[model samples]
Target: MMIDNRLCGSWDMISNDNFEGFMTALDIGFAVRKIAVLLHQKKVIEQVGDIYIVKTLSIFRNYIISFKLDQEFEEYTRGMDDRHCKSVVTWQGNKLVCTQEGEKKNRGWAHWIEDDKLYLELYCEGEVCKQVFKRINS
Candidate 1:
């Protein structure tokens, strides 16, 4: 139940790549996708006991997920994709990897720390969106 301390903090998005392609693969509307691309997303991760709470924040919208490692949960991606998913997260080495199963194929995301920054790779339907975030005041 001990989560990695490196990921337990606030992070601000510094770079986002291939986000449009990723959104397109998810069948998101053009208008929503446009706004989503411009959003400066922030992540706040909190761990208590065996549970983890991850909040993806933005001015346009916000998404939150809470679960324990190695456990599956029904995830409703409310403001993001508006889809229902069976999601499970597990630790692979120092990286936290999540697999989402639903309508999309090859859907999942991973979070890891590298070069003093937080890195995220969101993928669905053969499209991968890579995002980098910097820690806030460490």
Candidate 2:
């Protein structure tokens, strides 16, 4: 089935799994990593025109970020990153492809849905991190 671009709108992050072991690999302190791993993170997404805003919320800390699809721009990954990046994202089939260029090499992410399940793949420095989430409806 073909998806409307609006399908990228409003997504809730129900669950997440780290694949690149970035938290541990990046030497994130045990305390912070512990909290991050244990805490439930909810992602709220909104699409207005060609822009997308993603908000990662939790008890310990909250992060708000925005990106434009298919349009390259400077991105500052606050909370998760300290450096600046050049990024762009576009849709491929049912999946969203993201490319981030900066201090880290081979950084990008892809998002998609299947069987009502949410999938996220984050990449950095040749390491690929994958996370999957099931949709929750009330």
Candidate 3:
């Protein structure tokens, strides 16, 4: 299967659900979590060959993670929830699925595009956060 080039673009967050629970699962402080929920999040993805650079940008904090497909790398999620984890992102059909192994249980996220929108499902412990983004540029 061929990867869709449309996945490389800037997406603005349209909605977020259960994000507070997800953040709480990550042990984020109440003040930080409150600020996080109020910030408008934007995601930018740049895919070249098998390498991908993904950025989550907001006024409160910004995070950038770069990795090659099927390669495991140490990811330090700073500015957001500060944690270190071993992460690997692989392609499942047309969706990008990531698995993170570390202190938290069931920690990972998946990214997929549908109907000109980008969907991200973030899960940790029993909490699942769903975020939808509309494509701003491709």
Stretches of candidate 3 exceeding 4 Å from the true structure: 1-3
- In order of appearance, the predictions have TM-scores of 0.96, 0.79, 0.94
Task: List model 3 lDDT by residue over 1-138, tens digit each.
Answer: 334677789999999999999999999999999989998999999976677888999988899998888889999988867899999988898789999999999999999988889999999999999999998854
Clashing residue pairs for model 2: none
Best by lDDT: 1
lDDT for each residue of candidate 1 in 29-105, tens digit (9 for 90 to 100): 99999999999999999988788999999999989999999999999999878999999999898889999999999
- Minimum summed lDDT over a 10-residue window in model 2 is located at 1-10
- Model 1 error, position 137 (Å): 1.3
lDDT values for all models: 0.93, 0.68, 0.90
Question: TM-score of the candidate numbered 3?
Answer: 0.94
Sort all candidates by TM-score, best to worst. 1, 3, 2
Name the lDDT of candidate 3.
Answer: 0.90
Q: Give the top-scoring candidate (TM-score).
A: 1
lDDT digits (tens) for residues 1-138 of candidate 2: 223444444456665667426665544567777677777666566676666776767788888767766679888877765668898877788787878888677777887877666677877765666666654453
Q: State the number of backbone clashes in model 2.
A: 0
